[model samples]
Target: MNGAVQAGYAPPTGPDRPAPGRRWLRWLLAATVAWAVLLAVLTWVSVRDDPPTVREQRNLAEAGPVVDRAVGELLAAAGDGGAARLVPDALRRGCRITPFADGATLTRGVEVLLADDDVRGLLQRVADRLPAEWRAGVRVTGEGPVLRADAGEFVAVQGRSAGPGRVRLTADTGCRPIGAGYRAPTAGGGSEAETATELLRRFGGAEGPVQVSAAPCPDGTTARTATAVSAPSRPDRPSLPGTLSQFSDGALHVSATDELYAYRSSSTVVAERADGRVRLTVSTVCRR
Candidate 1:
């Protein structure tokens, strides 16, 4: 038996070994899978814990009845006694009210159209009606006269011009959110101006240059405005420019040039077409 060997039989040595390349590939595949899983978990955590965006806050404020009720209460209070004499019928009829929230602050504003002189009188009336606590801070002057009163912590009353014949009266109350510190969710888009330019180039079919500029608001936010003129594809069928309606339903990732802070909000689009030329303007607010 030792002298005779079975046909095609060889002496056994050790267990079979995988080639080096195969081993390396296996390790690489495992690493990739682990990395992907880790990334998914982090993303889930981020989204779950992220604070609501400013736009979301604004939407909530707009939809909620609290602001409306506040406005109604203020109006009712003003209408009481002889206050009705101070507010004109036309002003009352044209009144518009909006309530919004910024961070922990809740703001409700009422706007009315009136003559320049009427605005002064209305402000005076409002000042007189404000609570005693707000009276001391109340100041009135010419050149866009404003009446402001500090009610309490992060709460105040304001009266200013919405435009030439428009006056806006607003009240703000701040109630900071309690508990864990909030972190603003990252805005997904790059530069808002760049995004606007790209969208215009892709859709506008412009014949000349596009202009983009940044305008800072009194609030800390910045507004990026992009303008372009598009040539008509055909003489009879003029080009229709961009519009907010186009992007209102879509989630946009926008950022600022200076701060590079990004946010996800719908880009405000405005478009006009005339005389075989389409004028498109896109603007979006970027949080610093």
Candidate 2:
């Protein structure tokens, strides 16, 4: 047995051995990489449980449907007296989805007509209205109130007050490999054509074109909106007051002026003069 005080020279097994700290550092790096792999695998397995289908397999192009559905949920949460539109923010900036490849994200927006004071109430309503599975909640921040939730299929939903009398809701798909480019989902069918024709005739202006868009409602109904532009403003405009009188029964009105008229009758209608042309819009009103 060698004693602590043995004065013999120690035998060398090799040129030099790795430092203990260096060996531990190597293990640390290996464990970090293994932990990352495990996290990725767990994410994949969890996504498979999301209803409808697994969301991670979808590319930016294929994620449109999920985003559109999320928009519907957001709008429905805003209640029936809201006029909303898809204000897309299709900026796919660069991100590192993996060490070897660049990734991208898809963000779509819904711009709703919200008064300044309505911001808080609306955000709270959305938090409550979103599906129970989403774990929706609202938190006040330095900027303002931010409502965030999970829209199934790996989509994140957020709503914030954009400006006075306006609120913007966004659905975002975090970073992912740029599997394919993006294509917007097509709007559903609605009777916007017919309404556009009638409204144009009433305003004594011919309809140039009509664009219709529809989204699924929280109540399992298809909410539709139709808009069209009329020719140059006509002198023989139908009496704005007289025309709206028909829908005046038990309806809510706003912005009644010679240039702009907005109200919620059987549906929500807003007519305003834009660039000397009258642009009219009708949005679906779901009666709670």
Candidate 3:
């Protein structure tokens, strides 16, 4: 070894070609495990931080019974048979009361069998009494009346007569932070039918003049009916039902009784074959 060291070079005594392929494989396995751990951590964080959807927050299943109880209590307090009976019917028609950070909203389809005056009276009573019972604040603004209460913070209530008998009641009852403002989900404005439905839900009846007609039924009964239409003010523009449009193409058909009592209302979509034009129609119908 001393002679070799003193010479030009020493002979190979140990394996020094390169590290085994297994060493690189082991490093790769370790790196892969680290990457997987990082991904799992990131996924966990995302899931934990993500917020719930509006529908989830509403939790109809959990809130339905609560709302039912509240409404029942209110009805019991009112002792008004007309209002008491109608609320249950409205609830059965997929009506719901969903809570938010500031308050809760109540929505229901309306098809009342009672007189219009009675329905209006009942609604007024509800608007008047609910806030008092909940100890909520009431504020009448340009948009309409609003009710506010303290759930976790300040909650509010706002709603309207969706249609002739349909009602939409909103209350602020959420715990989360509110941004700009809260706007409840409404029907989309895609087709004439959709627009008509939304118009009825928003305003209940058409603002234009309604047409009346009568036809004899096969059962020897007279069928009295009322119809109304809303059309685009200009040919280039589209029209919506209710008082918003001028062309008078939006149309509605309802029973004469409904027209008289103002109990039931509807929205319809009509398509003209000649020009392939679509329009919305809103109508009110009376029940037998």
TM-scores, all candidates, are 0.29, 0.65, 0.26
Residue 132, model 1: Cα distance from true site in angstroms: 2.4
**Model 2, runs deviating above 4 Å:** 1-57, 81-105, 114-116, 174-189, 203-207, 235-245, 285-288
The order of the candidates by lDDT, greatest first, is 2, 1, 3
Which candidate do you rate higher for lDDT, 2 or 3? 2
- In angstroms, the error of model 2 at 60 is 2.1
Instruction: Compare candidates 1 and 2 on TM-score and give the better one.
Output: 2
Give the per-residue lDDT of model 3 (tens digit) for 10-96. 555466554567678989999999999999998788658855444324343344333333333333322221211112111122223
- Kindly report which residue stretches of model 1 are placed more than 4 angstroms away from their true locations once superposed: 1-73, 77-104, 136-138, 141-143, 178-288
Indicate the residue-level lDDT of 146 in model 3: 37
After TM-score superposition, the amount by which residue 126's alpha carbon in candidate 1 deviates from its true location, in angstroms, is 1.1
Q: What ranking emerges by TM-score with the best candidate at the front? A: 2, 1, 3
Best by TM-score: 2
Worst lDDT 10-window in candidate 1: 83-92
| Alpha carbon lDDT at 179, candidate 1 | 21
